[model samples]
Target: MVQKRISEAKEGKAEEPNLLQKILSMTVQERKDFWDKQFMKCIKCYGCIDVCPVKREEPEELSLSKWIEKAKVPPPYPAFHLLRAYQVWDTCILCGECEETCPAGIPLKTLQDITQFFSPEDVFELVPGLDKEIKDVILRFVDSKRTQFRRVTYGL
Candidate 1:
């Protein structure tokens, strides 16, 4: 069933609209409505963030509550939340720790895995072996951003 869902998602044939696009397209009301439903299970235990290996790389100010708060404030651009969502692709190891720890029983790992499919860099990371061509591609992708930003931003 998981494989089937993944295959359908890859084919853009999932019954629900693409979550990445939907998140990118959300209005204020829509964003709030959507997150409220998803977060209803959240107990504010901070288990997800706590277990996330990449939390150290995330901005100190970015928190689940902050994301929910952002959802309530505006439309057209969910810049902070969207950026944070994208960052999940860079940090997640598909470890499933967050899912297991979630007191609310949210499928956090599944959400993260599905979200990764929408990130080209994350897709590249899933390639089977490291070869010269793959190395070149990864370096080029990394180098492009190095030139684009001044500070040291290691993760995507």
Candidate 2:
């Protein structure tokens, strides 16, 4: 499989990598720097969450604010955007609203894509009943932040 992919890349038949693949392929420091640059541009408007269809109130037992308090614009390492993505990891609908609503142009939807869409199969091994394929859809991410995804074969 590895050799096939290498040969295909050399032959120009390899599929173009998506945002999730491209971002995940980055080195640790590169990923951190990418996120830092993206988050640093945030004005802390919370517009991403405001426009999210999956936005839900944080549960007390699983609260995240204690560990990551609200701060000024260009907030700390784990900004609200990151925390919000963590909170919705299991329930994200991937409608692409958050990315569209972000004023700073952060690619927040890619986080959702990376976590649930293209993630490794064992990621949900501990959750006996969780079927990751059930979340898969005909979604694609372009170079721009206009990636749109709708649940293709399931009723919401």
Candidate 3:
């Protein structure tokens, strides 16, 4: 599925979209409605963030995992998951820890997968917890704000 998504992304197809691409094209209301179902199960325990091995253990409140608030009993819709998706998308190695740690049985791995579908093929090797150096470089490049960003590599 990942390979197919990458292939379709590279091709820039506009015809009938697959399930992964469908998520990207969903309207604001449609997206909110869709995620509402999934997030309703979340208890805001932050277990998904805690179990994420790809994230840096930073004490700073704005750091990746710390961006999620501790006070919200129920997480704020899909925002938590969306933020987490960007945090780990390029580096996730398909580990199921986040989903496993979720007491609510939310499919966190699947959510991450959907987000990673658009990650740059060069940056996202799906290599597991062993690519910290490469992940850091990618994050640094993004934070530097060198260009209009989208993971898809066009003629830029």
Cα RMSD (angstroms) for every candidate in the order listed = 11.8, 10.6, 9.8
The TM-score of candidate 1 is 0.42
Mind giving the per-residue lDDT tens digits that candidate 3 earns over 1-156? 544665576578545665445655555556556666768788887788887888764423225344446777566545566556655654677798998999988767766665455443321332122134435544554454335463432211
List residue ranges in candidate 2 displaced over 4 A: 1-12, 61-65, 117-156
lDDT of 1 by residue, 1-156 (tens): 545665666677887744544543445556556554555555556576677777666543333343344334331222222333444544567887877987777556645654454443432233212234433443454455457643324321
Model 2, residue 23: C-alpha shift (Å): 1.4
Question: TM per model?
Answer: 0.42, 0.62, 0.53
Please report the candidate that would top lDDT against the real structure: 3
> Could you tell me how far off, in angstroms, the CA of residue 31 lies in candidate 3 after the best superposition?
3.5
Counting clashing residue pairs in each candidate, in order, gives 0, 0, 0
Per-residue error (Å), model 1, residue 68: 4.4
Winning model by TM-score: 2
How far out, in Å, is residue 48 in model 2? Answer: 1.1
Q: Using TM-score as the measure, name the better of candidate 1 and candidate 2.
A: 2
Question: What does candidate 2's lDDT look like per residue over 5-118, in tens digits?
Answer: 555655678897555545545556667677778777987777877887877886442344544456656755443554566456556888989889888898887756655543
Give the least accurate 10-residue stretch of model 2, judged by summed lDDT. 136-145
